[model samples]
Target: MHALPDIVGYLAAIIGTICWIPQTIKAWTTKETKDLSIWANILVLLTITLWFIYGILIGSIPLILGNLISICAVGAIVIAIFRFRSQ
Candidate 1:
């Protein structure tokens, strides 16, 4: 049904957005990203980038916001990982 897709999208966006909070909090508090894999993060970032673009193309606020937040969270982790790794 058409309604099912909307419901699923909303739920997915909420869960995906909230799921990122822990990683963001941990990175902010610990300022350590040594445990995160560069390749993994890169892949995730790229995926998010594509999702964000898709969201914009379709004018989906949930997708846009969710992926935008994910980008920030993943980007922070990547920065921390590199910073801590160097030190």
Candidate 2:
């Protein structure tokens, strides 16, 4: 069965999703994304969006949930990038 693979995917997803938290927290606390590139963020968002779509198409729970959470986490960072720009 594919259960093992799916479980692995979920574990991987959890790790990937957690990877963004530190950056997000730093951005939120410092209110700085001055060094971050908008293009890079956009590209990352686009890639994640595609993954989310793919997950939907395949009906993989791990892919779906992981990417959804990732979208929100990374999305927050992107929003913060725009929201906390230095004047």
Choose the strongest candidate by TM-score.
Answer: 2
Off by over 4 Å in 1: 1-8
TM-scores for all candidates? 0.80, 0.81
lDDT of 1 at 9: 84
lDDT of each: 0.84, 0.84
lDDT of 2 by residue, 1-87 (tens): 899999998688779867877888898888989997878877887888899999999897777787888788789889998998763
- Tens digit of lDDT per residue, candidate 1, span 1-87? 699999998788788876866886897788877777889988988999899999999999978988999998888877777777765
**lDDT minimum window of 10 residues, candidate 2:** 60-69
- Distance (Å) between predicted and true CA of 8, model 1? 4.4
Clashing pairs in 2: none
